[model samples]
Target: MADRLRVIQWATGNIGTRALRAVIEHPRLELAGVWVSNPDKAGLDAGALCGAEPTGIRATGSVDEACAIPADCVLYMRQGTDIDEVCRLLASGKNVVTTRGDFHHPAGMDPALRQRIEEACLAGGTSIYSTGSSPGFVTEALAIPLVSLSRRLDCLTIDEFGDCSSRNSPDLLFNVMGFGQPIGDFDQRQADHVKADFAASLSQLADGLGLVIDCWQAHGEYAAARTAAPIAAGTIAAGTMAAQRITIEGLAAGTPRLRFRANWYVSRDIDHPDWDLRESGWRIRVTGDTPLDVGITFPVAPEHYAAFTPGLTAHRAVNAVAAVCAAPPGIRTTVDLPQVLAHLPAQSSAHSSENLPT
Candidate 1:
């Protein structure tokens, strides 16, 4: 802990706030600066934004200002799909860790954009890492490790089931997810856009396990609300789309070998009994000689689960800062980095021992 990594937290929204807090509380990290999108948030203390004691590190609206600060890494949590700013940060000689979906991997990225990111990394001699709960931990990080035990692997499937009723972002729920639209109006193609990202992870897994993917396919379905469901975004009519299921499959030599399934609903009582439902958690099942099944549950109150997802996303990126900084200059994934362990402060153990009875 003698040489702590200096971290600059970019953006301070739901995910950013959690990353900011983690950076502040981490035993091996130092808060150097913060970048915020809102002009009003500029000059406010970073600790205060995360609801912690003031650390005197003010958030700035200028990306230039944040990048100029002497820091070992930047935890980029801004809300958007843009990777231009992220590449710029890396080009400034700061290792980057982000939850932004676009930079999840360069495998599916546009050639020009991917080249730009590679150029930036080489120019600055810094590395960038991207991870989150779904495209990241649930499918690749969690499921891929389980595949190692398969002696005669047949297929691997990862399913994530959760209720998004409490989600606060109208843009995410209505625009991106098409939650309240009529079942007929929901475009399967739009929903299939995520296939590329999932495919990238599939490719990573295939490469790791020494398998070749012949082709890939994506499918989507929706469930209507049985009754009017009033959510934070708006009211979902009795017949409107209340839930969704998306499946991406990787076929190896005409056989579906790897699949990623996601089921998200407003509530469990929706009119889709056929679709699987879990209050909130991830399930990984591998079919082969030694079949394996693993369930990871996030045992939080229903209302709190909405917030828990973002925290997990942020922590995944924040926890990788050290490993990302130590890695060779380039875009990296969880597969390329060492096992990232959650290292608590020494005082935590000492404090626990002090409370023990003699």
Candidate 2:
């Protein structure tokens, strides 16, 4: 029996809760602590929160308490990032692998903020990185190998199609997303955020390949529902925004090199003439010497969509803990760390831990 990595599950929300369960079940990882924002969740056993047996460790509401717990790494899954809190954990010498979008690319980050995080990492000699399914996986991870298959490159586009019909949140679909609102134009602020968010990952990708992206660009379009359509969230009336596609691109020498397009819709029955909307999945296309188009489909049925969706993000973060911990202290991007490998529970018993690539 060798030493297993001690991991703290920070903030037990949707993705956080999923990470918490994974940390408990993972054979090579041990659950060190659980941090919860909700006061009611505190004092409860960590396992009980995730529908598992009590594991002796209890949830705590205080960030100070979470940092004080001696651990190797923290799987940070908080809804929104708190820089001060994140710095505190790093300063306490605990490495962090987060789903938050803040630390993806150091150069793309605000100069002052990147310096602050780098200082914290240097002070504590720890490492931190951000990753997840869409911006993390589809935007960067999957594209890395595809680009290797080409010499002369024209453009690479990653398309993410999400059918929100199975999502049961009315407020998220209607008010927050403006999905059921009359089609005029997509919100500018959201468009700006989208541009900035995906730009971070794309810039990191370009940097990894020794290519420089001169700038990032964004464009958005929408389609109105042709008729009233019922969804799990609720009913979307006719003449409202039923589908939206936002494309963000990275330019090199004024030429678009890297691109990501997100297609979200409540129904395929929209007013658009040639819009291709389908279930949740990703398609990555490369136009180059070796032209390639790869389609990744999430085979889960509609009823089980929510059940399996979180893993697309959570599992990667959980699996990345050891890789980030072994990485040199600083802001490590997907490009910086070694290949993150998954150590399933079955693998632990069937094979020796030494078999894992270092």
Candidate 3:
């Protein structure tokens, strides 16, 4: 217990809040410091932000203050990717585990930016990793093992289905994601960013399988609501885009090999005829000599989804702290690191190691 890794929680948003509480509760990690960009959040007890018991750690808004703290790892779950801030953390001798989608595949990143990140890693002898529930887990972590069973692999596709009806964030659903907007109002720039994000992830998968991806392609499609539908986020007027699907493919020789499709919908009363949107879950289909189909569903109810979603993304990144800290200096992908061992809390009486398979 005394040898626990000192960790700094670098944000206090939804995902970051979960991570902050997790770092406080994790037996293998010590809460070294906390950082917040919002001045109002600064000077507050770390526990006050995440609803945990006060641990005497106050949040600071200063970059220099965060970097000066001697911590083994920094849990950076900020909303967007701040390259300069992240590089500073890396060069300050603290390994980073982030939920940002940018650093998943270093090879797919801008060559100059990749080199800059690597240089910071090498300078501090630290490592940085990006992970989350969808892009990190269902795509790469789950896809890797399934594809390994195929000696003659053809194509692997990941279908991620999410129901955002229960989410009450109108800004996130309508303004940011362009969900309730008219068909023609779909933002091309946002679509491009989404495409770029998924392309990067799919490319990482291809890189791991040793598949030569000649090109990466991305496509975004939408389904309009046929009638007005009331949901938690608000009403979706008829003819407005209600559902969105962004598919990213890694192709070789003009053939698709690795693919990922994100299916997010607020209402089922839509215009897509062929698409059969499943519940909130994930499906992986591997086409090969030993083809495999797998489905992972979130059993949590819609009302409880807001509370449930953060853990899916935050916990994995928190669990990977040990592996990230141990990794060599650079951007570590799922293939680069060992299988993330989720060291869960031990049971006391009814169930213990005796019940676990050796």
lDDT of 1 by residue, 1-358 (tens): 5699999998898889888887888899999999999999999998788877799999999877887899999888787755778777888899998786666556767899889999999988999877877788776778767887877889998888877776677898887777778787446675578787788877777777788888888988888888999886777888888888888999988899999888888756678787768766888899999799888887666555655566778888888888899999988877778887777666543322113332
lDDT of 1: 0.81
lDDT of each: 0.81, 0.86, 0.86
* After superposition, candidate 2 runs with Cα above 4 Å error: 347-358
For model 3, the stretches where C-alpha displacement exceeds 4 angstroms are 170-181, 226-228, 237-239, 347-358
Cα distance off (Å), candidate 3, residue 146: 0.9
TM-score of each: 0.87, 0.93, 0.91
lDDT per residue as tens, model 3, 1-358: 3599999998889989988888887778899999998999999999899877899999999989989999999999877889999999999899999999989899878999999999999999999998988789888888888988989889998998988888899999999877889897445565577777677777888887889999877777889999898989899999998999878788899999888888999988899967778888988999989999888887776666667778888989999999999999999999889999877654332322122331
Cα lDDT, model 1, residue 84: 73
TM-score for candidate 2, please give it: 0.93
Encode model 2's per-residue lDDT on 1-358: one tens digit a residue.
2789999999988888878888888988999999999999999999899877789999999888888899999998887889999888898899999998888889878899989889999989999999998789877777888898988788998889999987899989998887888888667677778887789988888888887888888988989999999998889999898899998988899999998989999989988868677567888889989999888887776777776777788988999988898999999988877888888786432222223332
User: For model 2, what is the C-alpha lDDT against the true structure?
Assistant: 0.86
Which one wins by TM-score: 2 or 3? 2
Best by TM-score: 2
